[model samples]
Target: MKGLRKITPYVPGEQPNYSDMIKLNTNENPYPPSPKVTEALKNFNPESLKRYSSVDNFELKKALSDKFKLSPEHFLIGNGSDEVLAFCFLAFFNSSDPLLFPEITYGFYKVWADLFHIPFKEIPLKKDFSIDLDDYRQNNGGIILANPNAPTGLFQPLEAIEKLLSENADVIVIVDEAYIDFAGKSAITLLENHPNLIIVRTLSKANSLAGLRVGYAIGNPQYIRIAESIKSSFNPYSVDLLAETLATAAIEDTDYYDKITEKICQTREWFIRELHAVGFDSLPSKTNFVLSTHPKLEISDLYQHLEEQDVFVRYFPTIERLQSYLRISIGTQKEMASVLTIIKDYLSQLR
Candidate 1:
């Protein structure tokens, strides 16, 4: 079992796989995808399945380029951002020096590092859970920072990100903007001059296409080429035909994207305020999920109680800093209201 014994696998949030529960554990959008996505699915021809999926790289790449106003040569699409990230780690982070990343950011980064046998350093986050970029400027192999970092949901301003890119030109720097659609700014603007920079993104979070599994990386042409080469050598058709078409549809329907994101943000703000009004506090979040804890309540009991009520949220009960916290994904307004009611009822019974 050496393969299994190599490292601990990353544990994602629970998926109930049933429709009865109010699931908020995964950072998935509660809104439906653009109508265009549905239309694309309906119009698909079964005959296309016979041929190996031919993702129109020119078209999908052009769509991404037009949206970001970047060159088509600068983009590489993967099955998911996770695969894109894996490609990046393999393509760029091969040095003997330890790769650098925040200790508390996305869990999958560490998983990928271990799986690839890449040496990495887990730089500690500051007391407020903010990444101290200075800790990463040391001599290192490469870097991957998750903006609006996962589970905690705090966004680092674009200025700090720019500084990191500016100071660390020697190492490959990856900004995993999986949640950037919810957060305001993207570091894509920095790609023009920073040849060392790569921005990995996914439509899964904001487009309600978590099931579709499409993610892309944007960077300078040379770096993009390196990743694309690796991808081709491994799997020429990493993305299927239906996925490519639907993903393109989602990308083109920018209006639906904006509207749903606005709704999620609005709901997030209200949920934070309401949680505070009831004595539970949450971190200021730009992502569609909030990491929260009550000062006096036992987090474990609260987590279990909510689960019993058919309400599912994330609980990192074993992590030192996260033991007392529960990460709740933003759902529809009504779903969140139900969560508030349940939490208030649970707290009142304690009172």
Candidate 2:
């Protein structure tokens, strides 16, 4: 046991294998990826697996660069945004000063900080579950925030992000925009002015490519170079050929992806309204999921009821602030209607 690393790993949502079950726990997209992704997969040469994938990630990076209007050098691709974030923590958070993040934000941030032995300070979110921008005004080695933050699904406006970048211009500030597509504009729009800003994105949610595990970070060329150096030293081929090909195809099919994202957003709003009608109130959400609770009902009891009916949503019991809430992902129209019906049945039984 000597010199062994002991740390708690991030617990991902349960992936149930039931064909009849409605799964919305992990915030994955309900729809399948673009037809382009399917065609790319079918056309990808199986013989290419004999060799290592492109070490530079040029193919995928070029696709992303062309899509985002950035040079290829501005991207650092990874197996997932989680990998990209881990690299950022290791490469940029070396200073003795503490790294900063919202205490109640993405659970992975703490995992990475702990695993890397990077000092960190988790500022508590305000009573409304909104991040207090003023809390981040202090000195820190770096900062990472999940805009349209997880579990709560509340978005921080771009103006607030700009102010954070303006105040902390000297240190690295990473905006993890994994769910930004459903929300609205990206922090990428602010990139030209803020060299210290790093924007992390994933194809898991909006692109319906969670199965492929493709994620990348956008930043100034200098930051990208530093992260790339660390990535190459750790694992030269952080992205594989199949994933690169499929993800490239998925990115190029912007129309398909955009249409699905809008549908999810619209469904999210409708679901929130329906939940309100049933005496459940949900956070104003910008992401694909909503954190909701009923004033008079037990969240645990309701969560169990939904599960018993083959409907799955997320419930975080360990976090004090979220014990009373259930985070529900927006599914297809029929699936959402089923969930609503199941919830109503539960309410009727209580009466």
Candidate 3:
């Protein structure tokens, strides 16, 4: 029980398992996977289930290579970005040096650190919840940043990423770009020259493939090999045959992917305007979620009111700095409109 005893597991967002519940919490793309994914599933050979999937996930990695203009040798696929990150923790960090990350980053980083017993320090975000670039320079083991960080959805510019990579040539710099598709730019542009940089990406957001659990890592050939080695040691098959085939089709359906993500972006802008009108303000967000707080009401009350109405959103009452804010994922325009209407009605009641 040595490793088991040192555990603090991650707490996932609440699921809207009911038929009538409005799920605007987990930040999943509020859209369906591409038509291609459906087709791939329909066309899959049931016989393939008898054999293990290609351990290297060659075809999917090759498709990603074409997308990023990198060699298949430069990519590593995983069941999900969470698993990809766990493999990274095992591959790069150690107990001797504490890892460095923002206090309000994707919570999984801390979980992996604890599971691996990799000591880590959380650097506090600025008062405005923006990262302090200078603070990361004092890091010990390595770096992990979620571009357009979770919950807050605030993006760190590539210039900031470049500063970290350029200065920290001696250690690994892991950039979780799970929301980068929504954010417009990616650190993958820096991977060619920065051997220390590792970029983790996923299909859960923009590609609408969350249930299929597809994610990849792009980095120097060396980093890719390390991740693959760890993966092979733990579980060689990255995903089932169905998931692999469907993810390929999903990635290939570029037009559908664009249309869906574009719709979410347009709806998010409109939703933010509505939130501001309701006396709530948000930092500019590039992810599928918006984190906002109204100066007049506590987040707990807002959460309870929403929950009472079967409108599910994410609120982190335990994180000290985030206690006042609620993270609301972008859903269909209709779903968001309902959220706005509910807020407006509730505010009027309070008056």
| Highest lDDT scorer | 2
Estimated TM-score for each candidate: 0.97, 0.99, 0.97
After best superposition, candidate 2 residue 31: deviation in angstroms?
A: 0.4
State in Å the error of residue 113, model 1: 0.7
Best-first order by lDDT: 2, 1, 3
Check candidate 2 and list the clashing pairs. none
lDDT of each: 0.90, 0.92, 0.88
* lDDT tens digits by residue: candidate 1, 1-351: 464554789898877876779999888899999999999999999898899876436667888989988889989999989889999998999999999999988899999999889999999988888887878778899989998788788988888888999898888999999999896588888887788999999989998999999999999998889998889877879898888989999999999999999999999999999999988889899899999988999999999999999999988867799988999999999999999999999989998
Q: Model 3: per-residue lDDT, tens digit, 307-349? A: 9999999999889988899999999999999999999999999
TM-score winner between candidates 2 and 3: 2
lDDT of 3: 0.88
Number of clashing residue pairs in every model? 0, 0, 0
* Tens-digit per-residue lDDT, 68-124, candidate 2: 999999999999998998888888999899999999999999999998899999999
lDDT of 2 at 89: 87
Q: After superposition, how far is residue 50 of candidate 3 from its true place, in Å?
A: 0.7
Which residue pairs collide, candidate 3? Answer: none
In TM-score terms, which candidate is top?
2
